[model samples]
Target: MEVYHLYSGGKDSSLAAWILERMGYDVKLVTISFGLLDNWRHAKETAERLGFEHQVLYLPRDTLKKAAEMCIQDGHPNNAIQFIHERALEAVAKIADRISDGTRRDDRVPFLDLPKTRSLEDRFSVAYIRPLLGLGYKTIRELTEMLFIVKIRESEELQKADYEVELRYLLREKGIDPLGIFPRRHYQSRVLGWKTEETR
Candidate 1:
């Protein structure tokens, strides 16, 4: 079946797509853009390198700002991030019957709660899949390193590509410190041009 994969152009999403492809699923990568600020460029580039059909869907600027505002109000990003993620999934569900994301077992924020997960599946008549849900950080990192050549960096430096990055920008614009809301030391990876010959 064709699966619309929520892609971030980061290691985890890339790996999820790769695994789904290997499992013989028809995979199309979809990246959500919140208004003007998004990692669409990087995501498109990575999709080209990985040879996947890719597209960017836009979310309203106000929606993203509201989510950011919630984070600011709550003094934590968990709820806001989860809200944004669900919104993105909702958008994808409209386009495909099979929806998936790069969310792993170790992920905290942006994870759907049981009720929300069931609601999404029931409402959309779609299957929500998380291929990396059973994989730990070390396992994913090792697999990523073995399968592709990547450049790692602190997630903050990855430009306007991630939801957190946009949220941080919104918070800063409102004169709030994002550091006070989010945890320290999140990392993101980019495909540095090629996959290993072994994975070919």
Candidate 2:
């Protein structure tokens, strides 16, 4: 069956795609760009390196921001991620009927209610799978290393992202674990800080 992997230009997603291809699946890479990170370049380079076909999907900034806000109001980051994932899936499924992602069981917690539990056809209106859900990050990294895949360095914006820490600080002030909430797009320090750039 044909399969398409979500290509985030991150180590996990890239390695996941590599593993699927090695297992004799006809795979392609699909990336969604928010225009904040140079994710397009990273995904493109990785696809070329792996000799896999790739495609890019772009979403409007305002739409994403509104989604993020709604997610926070709902008191969960998973909701926000699910919303974005569904959007990505919709765009990707249009091209290839089958799809997959790099999310692992550990990355998706019990509280998160990820779509992993559902069969591929249930999660999206197309065939889908997550082969790496049973594997840990370390093992995935090892596999990628063995295949000589270069890790995509975090974008300058992501490298400087303090949103997590900032959120953690805010949570600590409220006496909660910073990691409790699923991180939304606006939760990224770079995206939130864009407004302050005008003052400087």
Candidate 3:
């Protein structure tokens, strides 16, 4: 089946797309833009490197603002992040027969709650897949290490990809410190390139 995989150009999303491709699913990569700052450019570059068809979609600025507001009001990002993620999925589901994301076993925010998951499946009549849902960080690390040459960096140090980065920007613009809402020391991985047989 054709699957639209939500991609952030990070290792987890990349690996999820790779796995889906290997499993013989026709996979297309999509990056959602919340505001002016989006990781779509890097996501496009990664899609090109991985040989997949890619597209960019925009989430309404009003929706993003509401999410940011919720984050600030709650003094945490979990609910807001989940709201944005679900909205993105809902948007993608309209255009694709199946939708997937890189949400892993341990992901906190941007994860669909059980009710939301069931609602999407029932209402949309589309499958919502998360290939990495059963895999934890350790297994993901080992898989990436075995499959690709990767560079690791703190999420804050990266080139502003992913929803958290954009959300952080939104928070800052409103004079709310992101660090107060988000945890410290989140890390993201970039796939430098594929590992060759000789290196393996």
List all candidate RMSDs to the true structure.
2.1, 10.4, 1.7
Q: Whose TM-score is higher: candidate 1's or candidate 3's?
A: 3
lDDT of each: 0.85, 0.57, 0.85
Quote model 1's TM-score. 0.91
Clashing pairs in 1: none
Error of 3 at 77 (Å): 1.5
* Candidate 2 per-residue lDDT over residues 50-88, each given as its tens digit: 678887777665545654565457766555556666666
Expressed as tens digits, the lDDT of each residue in 36-89 for candidate 3 is 685668778877877889999898988889989998899888898888888999
Off by over 4 Å in 1: 198-200
TM-score of model 3 (CA atoms) = 0.92
Q: Candidate 1: lDDT of 32?
A: 86
- The candidate maximizing TM-score is 3
> lDDT, candidate 3, residue 87?
92
Candidate 1 structure quality by residue, lDDT tens digits, 145-175? 8787787887667652567777888898889
Ranking by TM-score: 3, 1, 2
Q: Predict model 2's lDDT versus the native.
A: 0.57
Model 2 clash pairs are 77-182
